[model samples]
Target: MVLDTQIKAQLQQYLTMLEGDLVLKISAGEDKTSRDMVELVTELEKMSPRITVEHVQLERTPSFSVNKVGEDSGVVFAGLPLGHEFTSLVLALLQVSGRAPKVDEAVIKRIQAIQEPLHFETFVSLTCHNCPDVVQALNIMAVLNPNITHTMVEGGTFQDEVKAKDIMAVPTVFLNNENFAGGRMEIEDILQKLGSKSDGTEFANVEPFDVLVVGGGPAGASAAIYTARKGIRTGIVAERFGGQVNDTLSIENIIGTKVTEGPKFVASLEGHVADYDIEVMKSQRVAHISRKELVEVELENGAVLKSKAVILSTGARYRQLGVPGEEAFKNKGVAYCPHCDGPIFKGKNVAVVGGGNSGVEAAIDLAGIVNHVTLLQRGNELKADRVLQERLRSLPNVTVLTNALTQEITGTDKVNGLTYVDRVSGQEHHIELEGVFVQIGLLPNTEFLRGTIDVNAHGEIIVDKHGATSMPGVFAAGDCTDTVYKQIVISMGSGATAALGAFDYLIRHTAPTQELVGV
Candidate 1:
């Protein structure tokens, strides 16, 4: 069911009066005669006097209204709550249960004051691990402000839109008509532009910088370091200090550094950038960015920044299992990175889902450390590279289960087993395992960039050889761009390229009177 502002506020108030555990059930069925739905609600009511249940009918309700189905029911179902929409269901329940997720208060205030309805459409695929966080962040915004509707469209289902919009990745968030593109967003950043109370604020007196980078990932960091060293007044804004690299476990391929951990490498990079004169704003969320005489950036803290050039180094995220028990067992038995947690599952059986290179790699890695490895694939053929497929096939400890789709993860406190359906023979089976690593592949973090930059069919940013986007004064690099290879070293190299390009743009435009011809 679509929740409006009034109903959301009312539910929040209702939750504040109650105490104890709460459960909210959103049913897709319209008929009140469904026994399962009734039983579910009955169970919830029995849990605690504070318990509340909600049902949403897909067939017989308005597009965006909260309807009560039964006595004490919180909301009614109105549409399919799958993909990114499932986040909305969680938020609705959280609000009804009186536990608002921790969010920046200023961000919430800004979002609530919006006079226009803000639509955020994010395109994602089931295989992209990194896409979920972007979708979840938008869903949180929708929960706080009913005027904001967040739509999560599967990349395959919206092929036409993908082609038209030139999307090249998943988890791409589109705001109104502008594009925010990939990476996790800090709540404050979202509120600054959408919730702005100032109506007559003019851009007449705002000073501009030579370069402005939107992300603090490897690419953004590299760009900032290079540009700032070149004496450019570079300003780098990021939701967090490190981008996707912060979540990585190890880094073995970074040139110069023989072997390094993810956190350590990021720390070093941050240190290097700190040594320069660059204006680095950590934990700042960029709400809106526009290019006129200079690129304008509105921050969530109610501050505005201007720059002559912009670089988007926002990276991607990990994919998640939508099956039951997956979320419940996060960090318990379900993990996304093998390198991050493989040691914890030593001598224990583990299952690796997906047949791509990452899945095979994870399975092979786990096979070396774990007792056994179950490599489950939804398709009959292995989609990994030839070398990885060969290595995985050579491993006797790795059991390859082709044409298998994971239906559910079963466990009490941790993952004990997983149920899978065979697509070819229609047979269902369960395998016991201590951990399940989902290595489906990476999704480009580009949801916040809809209608703003030119992305590829895969939702990757479309950049020229010099890392420039379709929009002038804006550039992109690293994994976020539509580059053929996505490696840490390559992303760093691209960052350097983008920084140089941005530097050139600033020199040409900012110093138009100077005959700056040579390198």
Candidate 2:
């Protein structure tokens, strides 16, 4: 059987939701991948009476298309859609079988309104937790709009294409055969990239909020929920809902839950937030914030929102090495998110830079996929926990270098090697490798607040015990603040503290009604 008992049982339950019959057109060859594809499709056909299969010639061998009865959905899977992509395949089957996708009505309208014919091909790895979002998003677009087509190309099953395209990252998307975007993107993100207008006027005319949270991560979600529970007008504007949490793979530190993945946890957060009467503005970036009669927060799309109080829970992002060729080689050979990009470098030599817990964990993870993992640390020793360090040391193919400072990431079209200097010996060294995974640390996403609020030397917003920042009516939390620990639980607690603090401020100091200030 292509699927295990548990998976097959689950599939059987979900297959019952299909509203109508669907067809799976298979294009196969006498290869292992093709044979697997045939077996999987045959098994799927047997599981549901609504599913039927037909052998046909397609553009790519060992591929299949999910289509409606007597109609084409333009959604194709170029490889075995197992692992993290299994959910994508299930969603495709249901959607193609006439079940409506759970998307915003406005987003569905935007997808159907596209005038241009766009063919989107997303390269993905089955093991990558982040690839399914992009794959499922494009598949939904294809299923909704006849003018759009999308194919999920598994990189492992198409090595030649991956090499030719120089795709060193998972979830790399191409629009019309041109490199479009990399990393995890939501449906709204894709629409915005296609030049969808946000209509800032809608935001400008909205009533002023009692509390506005400027992020959507764990911290921001906590703040929004805490404030909304108080029966106040709470609105959250986030560039993306999950923020750095989406890139995270396994989150075991969350209280009450033994373990959970990033996407799953984010889904719970979204569901919880949906139960409250909070306004959520997704895919919106805060450009500036100023305090007048009321604090005015300006969005990048020229939308200005006023609030009686603001909570800056904007979290931090992965810190770059700031070395030469890092930017140019990004998505080529240099990458972050080891869980997302590790499988792409299978059997290839790669290096992980950093010595802390994140770096050591990355090296340990990469050692299993890559041929070799050379961990370069700037400090004299690995700073990871004892268990992690011991696990990393047990990896035979992994090498640990202490007191090593990365100098540059060298590459032409793609990364070939990297240079580093031995901090103690003052000697430079180079390692030949195909890819580099950076897990140094994170920098706060508080650049938009510089000079307006009090930030420390590291650009972290300084907050008091109550999570109130130097600027009155403004609070900071999570990794963006000068918090000693950057744990998720800590961030959530700080978020609550900030929300309560903002509520106290709102009650004690009532703001005078005034005109909204323009950015």
Identify the candidate with maximal TM-score: 2
**What's the true lDDT of residue 311 in model 2?**
98
lDDT of 2 by residue, 1-519 (tens): 678999999999999999999999999999999999999999899999989999999888889999988998999999999999999999999998888998877788889999899999999998888899999999999989999999999998999999999899989999999999999998989999899867675676689998999999999999999988887889999988878988888999998999999988888998999999899988888899999989999998898999999999999999999999899999999999999999899999999999899999999889988899999999898889999999999999999999999999999999999999999889999999999999999999999998899999999999999999887899988999999999999999999999999888987897423322220
Write one digit per residue (lDDT tens) for candidate 1, span 134-243: 65566666656657766665555445675576443344567776766543445554454444543223333545667888889889899998887777577788877677
Report how far residue 74 has shifted in candidate 2, in Å.
0.9
Model 2, residue 320: C-alpha shift (Å): 0.6
Clashing pairs in 2: none
The ten-residue window of minimal lDDT in model 1 covers 59-68
How do the predictions measure up, each by TM-score? 0.57, 0.95
Q: Tell me model 2's lDDT, rounded to 2 decimals.
A: 0.92
Candidates in order have lDDT scores of 0.69, 0.92
